[model samples]
Target: MLLHFISDLIRNPELQRQFSRDPEDTMRRAGLSEPQREALHKGQLEPVMKHLRAELASLELFAVVWVKAVVQVGSTQPGIAAPGSTLALQVLGDFFTTGAFAVVKLEGADLPAVTRSVENPGQRGSVLSCTLDVPANTPMGVYDVVVVNPDGHYGVLPKAFRVE
Candidate 1:
């Protein structure tokens, strides 16, 4: 619907900021684009709202952005573990594209895998987020929270806190 509008605008190209948050691309995708998201940090809602408006006007299938950040353990600093946090995945897209969700894995002794089914945070959708729980005896080593999409476009998110 609205996406059809953005498709009409894709001809301009500058509007298409990024596809953003492809679970399958996580393996090949590199580090986070911006570790400290100034937008959220500063609580600047303009850019987000601006994009949302553009997406709505575009009239795409779904006006939302989906994000899945598979945070790595032990990256924030030494002796710091995210015991309690509302882990969020940042997504950005217009009417042309909707967010993606697929498989999520917490690799460890048992290879616990889960299919993260989240709502797209597009202009008309809700943002994706999760809470991480560090295992009591979580080895105190490097662990990975890998996120993948069905189409195979993902990014190995930045490492999380360390257990110390």
Candidate 2:
């Protein structure tokens, strides 16, 4: 029952939105066990993923990354970065770590790079700094950046930035 609820939550963005607003009510209505409900309320994933993995022989989980902003390394404003320069994407999610990676899916190209930390891990909130290397020849247009975690779960920032 918990697995079914989780699957629905993953596939439906509307449900996710509602869950964010009222997690306790959502989990209760979904009939999750006490432990599972508590785990979710605390933003813990290990136990939930363990149960999910057991149900499916193999799985590639798809998750969400709450992107706070996408801007240049030193700029506070969002959007518009130079080609061949580094950009900083501030994101809030539990799946971020040194092991995570990202890809900028531009119209004609894909930029994949390892993520780096701009602030000390224990100092700031759950915000992570991902590096984006906009190619010199990348078309001057908006692009979507997708972040993939070590567990194969991914989240995308649709039309996240523009190259100038």
What candidate 2 gets wrong by more than 4 Å, as runs, is 1-78, 118-125
Q: Residue 134 of candidate 2: its Cα lDDT?
A: 72
Q: Considering only N, C-alpha and C atoms within 3 Å, which residue pairs clash in candidate 2? A: none
Model 2: per-residue Cα lDDT at residue 42: 71
Candidate 1 lDDT over 32-105, as tens digits, reads: 12321322224467754554455556533231232322211211112244433223332222111123431223
Cα lDDT of model 2 by residue, 74-144, tens digit = 21224567877877665554444445566667766787755676343222244456666777877787767
The TM-score obtained by model 1 is: 0.28
**What are the Cα lDDT values of the candidates?**
0.33, 0.61
Query: How far is 51's C-alpha from truth in model 1 (Å)?
Result: 29
Lowest summed lDDT across 10 adjacent residues in model 1 is found at 70-79
Quantify how close model 2 is to the true structure by its C-alpha RMSD in Å: 13.8
